[model samples]
Target: MALGGGTFTTMNKILPGTYINFVSAPRASAALSDRGIAAMPAEFDWGPEGAVFAVESGEFEKRSLELFGYPYTHEKLKGLRDLFRNIRKGYFYRLNTGGEPAKNDFATALHPGTRGNSLRIVIEAAEASTEETPVYDVSTWMDDTRIDLQTVKTAAQLHDNAFVRFQAEATLAATAGANLTGGTDGTAGDAAYQTFLDQIEPYTFHALGCLSDKPAVKALFTAFTKRMRDESGVKFQTVLHRYGQADYEGVISVENGLTGAADDTSAVWWTTGAQAGCAVNKSLTNRVYDGEFEIDTQYTQAQLEEGIQSGGFLLHRVGDETRVLTDINTFVSATEERSSDFGSNQTIRVLDQIGNDIAALFNTKYNGQVPNDAAGRVSLWNDIVRHHQQLQTLRAIQTFEPENVTVEAGDTKKAVVVTDRVTPVNAMEQLYMVCVVA
Candidate 1:
């Protein structure tokens, strides 16, 4: 728990899921929430990298014993405990099954959606005999608030009217902002100011999940700055974004002893294909609507646990695209950055082309913002009704035509018309949204 000094400590004792146990700098317990880690001495041994190094030797006893619970666990845990010595044997089998080379099979994609988290952990196995075949079970505990960033009905000012566009970028930014106290680089203890700047890493989930297997995903995402060597070395990079999703939030990186870009061929391929399904809430590929990175290893022996169970997601799907008109009249005049309001038949540059679809499901809270024309009213009204049915829906059109919206000099506060037509195209502009789940 860090305050202004360089000192850090963990809550010395606790059981699983105990809220009070955590580690940080002096008075740094609050930082745990943003980082999504519980550093209770019961589950973790806290200190700087080398600070804990001496404990392994006889030089200093560890301040405490701490273990991390990765929202999931292996099945037959109780039964497996009896054979705890067998974990090493089972792990070797898993090692041989590392699949393909990370560079080949691994995949990574930066999603534009902002509702998600990150995850990573070591997966030591339970002891088992070849006859019984020990299994690894997993469970999940997702935050109910993961889906709380609802369709905003009304906000006096907006950076952009097009909400769906750049969602992934914005989400990443928020995660970064939340995880910081101030700076980015540090050793054990810098000045009081330096320590504060260094601890803000976990809460900013700017970078999404490692999203791939040990052999590949970690190679792509760990924090390192690039460096040059006479022997031909690449630059080192530092971990940039923060993550705090589910119980598995912290610096997402590769596990030790695991080859990142291994010389092996299969390991590379496995990294790009299907990651060990290790993501926390949903598949990195957007396969399920609302998913949980839940593992039910406790029931591994049941044989019926193949199906993964998860909570709901605000899945986005493409809607009908035939109704799209290349021509659209800008309706609202915006003073905010990144958005535009075109007046009448003027054309707007379509910059928002990235999305799962082409139509919009709008919020009725914006009903007042629609233009007064007939067509504008219709589009606005229809979108509102559709959004009420499903809060987070898919949208076909994301980027609006960028145009210069000019209203008569005195119409500053008034809702100026952007369409070229004198009559309204649809009046319910504020009521509708473009991105809703189908």
Candidate 2:
């Protein structure tokens, strides 16, 4: 070989060839992540079993029948409709799974639920068929509506559709209609709810709704939320009905419920979506309740004040419409580590945005790729500064100083430590003014 032509940390190379070290100039690697995602565990009459499924707001109306076995206007989707009123996307887990699927001689229902009982398969001879080789027209119907139509010489040529799967091995025969039967809905119990929580752990949602009236179930959800937020570093709030005792920043206690609903926990659906969809700089205070349910907003002024004092997220009547009285979480007991500011949902949103975004930036750009050196630390600091500056511009936070952020190598050579300080901003919820004499 002629000489060494690679990077060097010292001038110990004895070769005469040029030893160069090329490095790109540091640039900001921080970008804020989007919100408007929520998670909910629901008991449905029909849906996918034992799995978490995503439903986007844009596709909810069009794909409702295929996904939930009901049209968008059906009464079964009222809770989902309320949820989608605010959130852009939802990770939904059906608590009632493991039920029996409806089946007939021709085909089987795609999912397990009572909705499959409405399905029927009709077979008739196609007009193009002859006596020697007859082609059959197979049509799958849900009630009176025809969902799928196929023409095949044998059952083996048939393909499955959204509603059901054809029995490829079964012989084809012309029948008026073969109705599917024996479909049953699974029971939603504590174990099923626990399974839903387990399945939803890996998902990233801004809010989670616990639509259970049982105190034990609410406690379970609250504990999960706390563990995820404190230990796992996943930041999200869980909305629970009448769960103000949680007293944690990661839980929002819905004080008011629906007026005429069997499940009084219905309000949690709307609150969860609203919380998830609220922008980092925005507040849900005074946001009109545009959901489907008629919320119980009959609270006295003293009660409303008490609700806020007890860290309850309440809704009250404002003129002709119901509106959010205060955007706060169940964070009543304040410690030196966490001040009263943590009670405000707006403040929590800002803090969560910073934590999640900075963690993402470090994990994606710097974790194992950047060396643990002074220059590398400075680069991280620059990115953090830029991120905070963006937050300041958005009015989510204020009083951010670049000098306050410090990144340094840890005791281990491979470890790096970061110290970040930020002041989150809250909305102006109270007005106190004095009239002066003219």
Candidate 3:
């Protein structure tokens, strides 16, 4: 954490974790009828410090304390979990022209997702012949006889000292942009739908500090915790994760076919009719009562066993070969152990992480198997979110259909409806927005 003092220190005690807003303090004004809102148009921002209520009278703040389940503790973790701490939360950006990390600048000039620097020097010698760039491993000026700029790292990387470097004062130019007036996304596929789609973020939201209206840290902390408990409890990301297993064309005995067809009389040719080498794969003996049911991806054998007893059958929703194999193995064990009717492939990876839990409950659907690239992942997840909106995520926020949703007057409340899919990782797939009481 960057202390107010000039020196930066490492905070060891802080183990990253997910959190939400929780309220304890009462409202000074009669703005919120239930949640202690100030009843007027206001900015209620939450962070590590506490609750920040921005009303006409003035901005108010509050503090929060959470009950964590971590078994071990130490001094290093001290003040680590402090609310609203800045971090490199899966995000990177180039600082402003004069900005430097070592120099200590918070607001950055470069936007996120800028590809790494790797450009050849096309220098044209001009002015004095003594011109040169910073000496790294080597220093060779761009040869044109007309100009002299030693090829150096990209300007974004060259924090300081450069007469002619990555960003040439005359050559390099940054695209000018104004504040985004509307939503972050310019095009509209399914803003409502995309939000419900789980977007498993890093344990870095606290670190990758946001430029929100919380004003101060204390207000942010109190509000964040209050919302965590008060918002909603049916935690999970809902998704109709589609699957197309390898085309199967194998035949078993008539008895196994369930038809008890005459072909079962002998060891007939088990032909997997496939024109293409699709590798028709199956669970060897996989079947789930020929239907569907929800199962958390993070559950263990005991949990699966308990869930199966409820009758419908349980399985994990998988998108890769590993999941398929694990689910099959677990199912086989359960079936053989109890002669049960449980099926394989029932668990789901809500966050696209190792488990199934929705941490960011703003999106409407749960999308997984996205590209490793940041931009691609965001796009693919958006599509999944649209799918969730179509499937009863939030009736108030539809894609093509405009269904007006209403909240009580003077209610400056923001509702983040999460996906109720199998096992949610967190509010990964969710939609977020402020509700102006109308």
Candidate 4:
């Protein structure tokens, strides 16, 4: 038998034949995470309740009917269309799911919502049916269009589709059509919004949208944002309508409203998507609004300047196109710890990326796995320096010095402290030119 031929901590083995230890060569553990993810609580007529669902940009148009209980072109999906225009993926929570489902003799709606009232079931005898085997052709319709068709001999054989669930006990009968009724949409109260916030806490999204114009509801979202950012270390900014009074870096206050729309806070949808989809090196300043809504951009120059000074994210008309005035958040009052640079959304994005990426690196590569020694600290410092270098290469940040990063032991043996400095770059929103001619 081989004697004591493994890794050693104290080298006090009695009869060791051969001791060997293998380890992977040290490599940089820095990698940038993808963006373009957003979250929102929407008052839709149909969807899953009490949970967050993911919607991808590429699949929204194709699976809209099944996912949202409406076709892609339906007016109900206008807000979602605007949001998906820029974002790659969205985490959506239905706020009006505490309602009653529509039902008929044959089937019941899968989800509780007013949209389910449009469902109709049609049953007819199949051509191949006989007196012995009475096969029925069952068709599910949403309004005039047939959505699903199945051939079954009895109601028990009829399977549930995306729209509704069949009543297995009901007898299958040949009927022209039976319309579903009694569906209702519940009111989205503060409790429903609070539930949405709690459910969405575990999700990692770059931006969040609050479409409520009520001050109390906006305050709720603002408080949630601050808590997630400061305490939980989850960095994300929330878009709100006319909430500049929040005066927090994590809240983006939209000053411009939309015309010809029932929802005055609809602009928040597009802004949230844009913020989440924007690259780390880019800014939304002067970016044209290509959404479906008609923005009210009739603010004068002085009013626009004042709005910017008050930490409002505004949209203005530029040569017959609606454009973002400036990409800023509601952070007018800044302290020494967080200077005026924190107000810029681009700056916030850089800081957030650094925080998230470094946290991920530590949790995955170094935390609890590496030895708490000088070599481990040096490894972490090297990874951090490489991350900063990559950011500088992407032009997201500038003037990053490797010497500025340091990792040291914390108060406890298991704890560590890291200090890093970075300068985030912003887009050129203003230009000054002076010329003299003789």
Candidate 5:
């Protein structure tokens, strides 16, 4: 009989062999995780059907044309460009659905949008020492220039290209150009956003930007955010335009969206990214608006104060520049004791960071790896203490004590219980003091 070969689940066959288990000591890292990812919906010229995708700031321009059939600087991409002006990277979902792809006599555009209408297919004779093979040079052109080219001798050699796919299976015939037509942009509805929310539920992002001013759409987002945070324990914030009554810790309602030039509330595009880009230990209060669009800052002093009182995200002129006055969430409640602390977005960030970090620590390090014994529980408590200690070291929390953390056996042998307390730190936002008379 081999030594240490028997299993130890239900009964131990000690007579035949012996079994033992070893676990590594829990280690908590002090490095804070990066947290600038954001999510939003938009009308794109092209993309995958009904899904969310990521686009980094460095690749947005190139990827936009490659995937969506339009360059980042195109007029149709202004809103998306504005979003990326301050955001370095993020996940984007297209809300508009069900559109027809533009088709030409030679091929069809990859996605449905007006941008595809500019595409044209050109066929020319292949350049070779001998033209006896009768090979053709196929070129995919957008406007006057060709984007993709291929050489094929037979119709069967003609494969699908990135810009357009081949349609004809007959004999190869040279043509001057065939312009694509009938490309149209799909319409956006409330259901489209709902689908986007559902598709993005599993994704982790710091903030969500809602560009619509529809009350019903805003309400749907508010409800979805509350449910995800409260029920599922997913932590993230959402920014919407002119949704002051949202009154939730996870929701930010922008009082003004567009700059004074237009009535559109496009400010949500930038605010969402900026809010997400803020570090966990920092705050966006008094942060300046450095994007292209001039945000609407036409509010009077009284109006600005009222907007803050109502938990609205307000931008005001600080001398010649416009800056965020106070970063706040819509959580105005006089009765509920815990509701008051949730007003500041910084406070929410701290709490959310703590929650997300601890959950990650537990799930990754402690879950199923450690046994359900008293020693294992104590080890978990120790890990928790170390995690909190690191948080304190980073100044994200204060007054953390190892003795405050406790872990014990749960109602069942397979479960464990944990209890702890922490005092999260918040940024300074206001100054009200009396100066002695000189």
Candidate 6:
């Protein structure tokens, strides 16, 4: 007889020690997660162009130089500065996804742009303490300050860094500095913006900003936003400047705002960050534009009314300050019964949260583990009830009757059907007061 029992492929054979797979509870999805991730494309000095670059809050200034090789206040970084200003207050992170690098004689800039021309490389010899060969200090300098330093005896030993790549067949010799020249920015076209979209498709952000005023570019963004929200199951809104379409609930078109000296579309920067930073349970109506751009509110009352009627995201002057009149997106329904329900961004937030949370719960925990029987269906229903109850507690929705939520087995034993409804709560945007004197 064999020392150990072996598995048999015979007729009624069974051999098993243990078969177990661990599963995590769906509690992680219940937490109120981070908010305000805004994505956009811009001209940058360094970093990978046509790829997503994540800049977390408070890291923009330092990371900009480290990655883009330029400061926020650089003359060529005006647009980036505008974006960082609004993002500083609201968004937790911003994703930059455009800009090509400029190549020079000695080394190429980390990113594509004329800013690369400002970079200079300095090679010096680091003194040796002992009786050994001296290590050369190869430093990458943007202007005066050294950003990266590598110690190498020969040019062949130099490795590529975030700032620049070492030139091949280069001799290691002490030189004052070799300034990079002929670096140029890539022409920004809709194709460049499309590259950004493609790179950011897998990312999750609250709002996407479209800086370009081109009709074709705006159309592409609108189509992308709609497809992502409706078909791809990704829920997020987009902010565009002066877009006239009000048929989609996922797009917020900025009608009028202050045009800074640098660019007229500077408002796109702040608006995108602010809309993205708005909490899921709150509305942005009447919120103050605390950004750096001076809004252009030189509009008549008639224009204001027309702008609102035409589904424009308008800002207006109020008591020596500019405030958002309505935090509405372009989502006016065609039917009278629908009314202006979808027009309010707050409503959309609630609905989006519900859809996202429920889908996450199903996909993460109950996808294929639970049986498709009565008990399993009840478990799913219980989870759904708990989730909606939590949303109700958050004041995101109201009028939730437990009886309205029902989960039943579908025609197929492997499927289950869920039917539930809840009234989404919106912030009080209007009031009717009657004054009476005794």
Candidate 2, pairs of clashing residues: none
Model 1 lDDT per residue over 1-438, tens place: 422323235654333443333565422111111111111000011122211111111111121111111112323122112112111111000101111111101111111111112211111232331334433211111122121132221121112211111122221111111211111112221122122223322221111222223333233233221111112122111111111111111122211111243321221111111121212111222232121122111222122111111111111222311111111221233346423332211111111111001122222323365555555544543433332222112222222222222222124443433321111121122345589788
Q: Name the best candidate (by lDDT).
A: 4
Tens-place lDDT per residue, model 3, 1-438, is: 442332224443344543344566732211100101111011111111111222211111111111111111322112222111211111111111211111101111121111101112332232332335422221212111112223333334333221122333322212221111111111212221212112212111111112112224323322332343236322111111111111110101111111333212111101110001011111222222211111234446675455433221223334421121122211223434343222222121111211111233223222233223445434433533443443224221223321222112122223222232322211122358899998
lDDT of 6 by residue, 1-438 (tens): 324344444545344443344567545344444456788776544556545667776776766677556666666555556566545432221223344455545577666666677788888878752237767888888887778888777778888877787777776667888887776554555577777788788887778888777888889999999999989888888888888673678898887755444336678887888777777778878988776667888779999888877778888888888888888888766477566788778888877877777777787767888888888887788878887887788888898877778999898877789999988888887899999989
The backbone clash count of each candidate, in order, is 123, 0, 88, 0, 0, 5
After the best TM-score superposition of candidate 4, give how far the Cα of residue 216 lies from its true spot, in angstroms: 1.0
lDDT against the true structure, each candidate: 0.20, 0.90, 0.22, 0.91, 0.80, 0.74
Residue-wise C-alpha lDDT for candidate 4, range 8-87, written one tens digit per residue: 76778798577777889866669888889999998988888778999998889899998998889988888898899889
lDDT of 4 at 323: 94
lDDT for each residue of candidate 5 in 298-350, tens digit (9 for 90 to 100)? 88999988898988998888998989899898988746568577898887888
Model 2 Cα RMSD, 1 decimal: 3.0
- Reference-based TM-score of each model: 0.16, 0.92, 0.17, 0.94, 0.88, 0.84
Model 4, C-alpha of 69: deviation from truth (Å): 1.3
Output the TM-score of candidate 2: 0.92
Q: Cα lDDT of model 2 overall? A: 0.90
lDDT of 2 by residue, 325-365 (tens): 98999999999988899899999999899889988898999
Better of 5 and 6 by lDDT: 5
Error of 1 at 349 (Å): 27
**Total backbone collisions, model 2:** 0
**What's the best-to-worst order under TM-score?**
4, 2, 5, 6, 3, 1
Cα shift from native, residue 77, model 5 (Å): 2.7
Once fitted onto the true fold, the runs of candidate 2 whose alpha carbons sit more than 4 angstroms away are: 1-26
Better of 2 and 3 by TM-score: 2
| C-alpha-based local distance difference test score of model 3 | 0.22
Error of 6 at 90 (Å): 12
